[model samples]
Target chain A: MVGSALNQIEIRRLVKAFGNRAVLKGVDLTVAEGEFLTLVGPNGAGKTTLMNVISTLTKPTGGLVRVAGYDLADGAVAVRRQIGLVSHKTLLYDDLSAEQNLRFYARMYDVPNVEARIETVLRRVGLWGRQRDPVRTYSRGMQQRLAIARAMLHDPPILLLDEPDTGLDQHAAAMLTDLLHEVGATRRTVLMTTHNLDRGLELGDRVAILAGGRIAYQAAKSELDAEQFREVYYQYVKQRV
Target chain B: MPLIMPYLRKVFAIVAKDVVAELRTREMLSSMFVFSLLVILIFNFAFDLRAENQKTLAPGVLWVAIAFAGMLGLSRSFIMEKDRGSIEGLLLTPVDRSAIYLGKMLGNVLFISVVEIVILPIFVVLFNLSARDLPLLVGVMILGTIGFAGVGTLFSAMVIHTRAREVLLPILLFPVVIPVMLSAVKLTAAILDRLPFADVQNWFSLLVAFDAIFMALSFILFDYVMEE
Candidate 1:
């Protein structure tokens, strides 16, 4: 039983509500190590709420959450240390230079060799060239890249990205896809939420269709075609509405 | 040893960063200096004090200028952080939330101290008074600024997210910080008049007690304010 409980992320009976409206109603899911799990849902399906709960950014009304072998309720701080996040929000200081932003986070995380780590991450994210420029001077794509650099600075084992592709152009999106692929290849667990079905299908190891605050359908990339996935997705949305 | 060192270092780092930024921009200090000078100038005309009248009112006018200018500086402390999204960045880091609070408080204290340092000489020149009890006056300034910053940091964090942030900071802050201001003004007056320390022990005790209580409360409640 102990060996069987190897999932990197696990949720059981996760329920969240605001006022009388239940956002996530008795939802359950598990993500294994190195799994690239993409959650695709309509606007009000509670994907972000679930992500927030898992990240310990929001307290759930009810449920169990475990990340990186630590129970969220019991070891929230440890779990937070293990999970890195990239949200639609850039979360970068606009006035600080790119280098300062990374250095600030490195100090916060108490990462060793902070200067070297900052240099390496900046180079990896293709921001080393513009490390001295204030983030306010960065373009949207550049800012997102720096955000990714911040998230990856600590080398956390799990990454939760909420629409990491929000404002990127085609070239940037492709680059992001490549970066995600690189991250996945290194065996880090990733849980991402997006409305982009085609990219989600192409990048995800497993695509999950969330509707009515529950996962209506989940399939490996090889198991579902685009048309089948779309039909089922739309059907669930219509039924829920 | 008490896990306070790292937080203190963090606070110093933030203060240093803010000092450097301000030195480069002169945004906060210039505004505070100009505004404080204007307040003192207005007081000069309003009170219409001759040489003898200046001595009696100088302490009150000096502190009033410092307090108002300090509030202006504290109010803007988190505005830049929030506007630049730096607060969220700090929160997402694995550092203790209390460290962030202390760090911000220290930054505010440093800024207010700088303003006070500049204003002290100006006050002396304006009122034509000798800088008596230099060490004690400096001590009072530090304690007073700490108390003001402790309460101001907490209120600023609360109002940073509110719709009426600019208006809300003073509204929530003034009442809570009144005890510190009262104690500070008394102590400053006592020191300026060359009064005995024992005579002002009451104000000193009040200052120490207010500083301890508010600092502890601010440390504990900071986590809730920073929660996403």
Candidate 2:
């Protein structure tokens, strides 16, 4: 996991501090190409901060971070071209219809064959039937699914999701799980931060626990038992708390 | 660098999307139109706007209405994006960041200009400006609105994430846009008074120069401001 396959993300001694407080202090993590890595962390554990850095939304204070083989410092525009981000919020205009939102993004991303791509993503997210409806009228689950479609429209090699399941109900959460399953099969490198331990661990090929502004533990999903993982999770969290 | 056509096309796409959104709800436009009308009505009654007062006071009053109404629209430009969290999505797009500013400024200009167009004829009757000045008035309005909207759009976006943005926008905007308003008011007054172009050419130059400066500054600063 450290350096074998084509690495999509390589972060070494990454530091992000706001004023006097450092949210991420010297973090190092690597995600292989096409790997599904779920990072479970508590609030203020720097999980979102790392995702922001990778997405080029936040500039790192120190250390090196490479996404899709582009350095985070100088290659932001290039990195942006190679990644798509889905945050907790839907980020779609409420008044715009689903079709309009997708098409708007499609044009902004300069996607060719815009009509075809919008249709493809809309259908994939099961929103094509209601594509003409305003996004304001959509349910939370539907919006999240449409967000998935939106993030995938440009077909970037890497995807970054931050607390996407925060506001979803059980049914919607299950739908998201299924959607992620289908998405993971495409061999896109995904780095998702989640609080839902059960579901998070279930979907990831590898799981990492982040606490105390750093990744405390990481292992392949098959290598750790569920009960043992719970013990290890709390053990790391207890020390940090 | 990316192709210029694609860059320009993205700017238009943002404008179209905003126009469609505004048309659906009429949120910003309706408020702006009504507000502009209210300002005019208040001035009509407040000042004893007789024939003598109409020349100086009316031009000032008309500009006051347009500037405040434009502010009403500009204040919401980025507020909508902030509320819906769409600003982040816009920034995440691969297009040039300046294109976003241009697109948003275009929408604001369109919105403010619409309000101006609706109120101008009414302004003529209320203030007794002859219809002969209509052509010149239209030109002045375009130049004035561009400068106003350019500065307003930038300041509004700058304060979008501030806690007191609703209160902050006018306070931050009015001072910076005072130069624009001054030139516009002087230009409109010159036209109404039947002054020679020589008297107003300086004002027109100032208006265009302010607009060009503001547009360029906003274009360069938008990317930095948008960074979280």
What is the i-RMS of every prediction? 2.5, 1.1
Ten consecutive residues with minimal summed lDDT in candidate 1 chain A?
A: A1-10
lDDT string, candidate 1, B68-180, tens digits: 89888988888777876666556666556677788889888888888888888877787777766667888999999999999899888888877889898888888888888
**How much lDDT does candidate 2 score?**
0.89
Query: Any runs in candidate 1 off by more than 4 Å, and if so which?
Result: A1-5, A18-22, B1-24
DockQ of each: 0.46, 0.73
List model 2 lDDT by residue over A1-241, tens digit each: 1223488999999999988999999899999999999999888899989988888878899999988888877777778888988889888998999999999989888788999999999899899899999999999999999999999999999989898898999999999999998889998999999998887788888999999998899999999877887888889999998
Question: Which runs of model 2 end up more than 4 angstroms from their true locations?
Answer: A1-5
lDDT of 2 by residue, B1-228 (tens): 657898899999999999999988998999999999999999998999788778888778888999989888888899889988898888888777788899999999999889988999999998878999999999999988999988888888889868999999999989998889999999999999999999888888999999999889988998888776
Among residues 3 or more apart in sequence or in different chains, the pairs in candidate 2 whose N, CA or C atoms overlap within 3 Å are: none
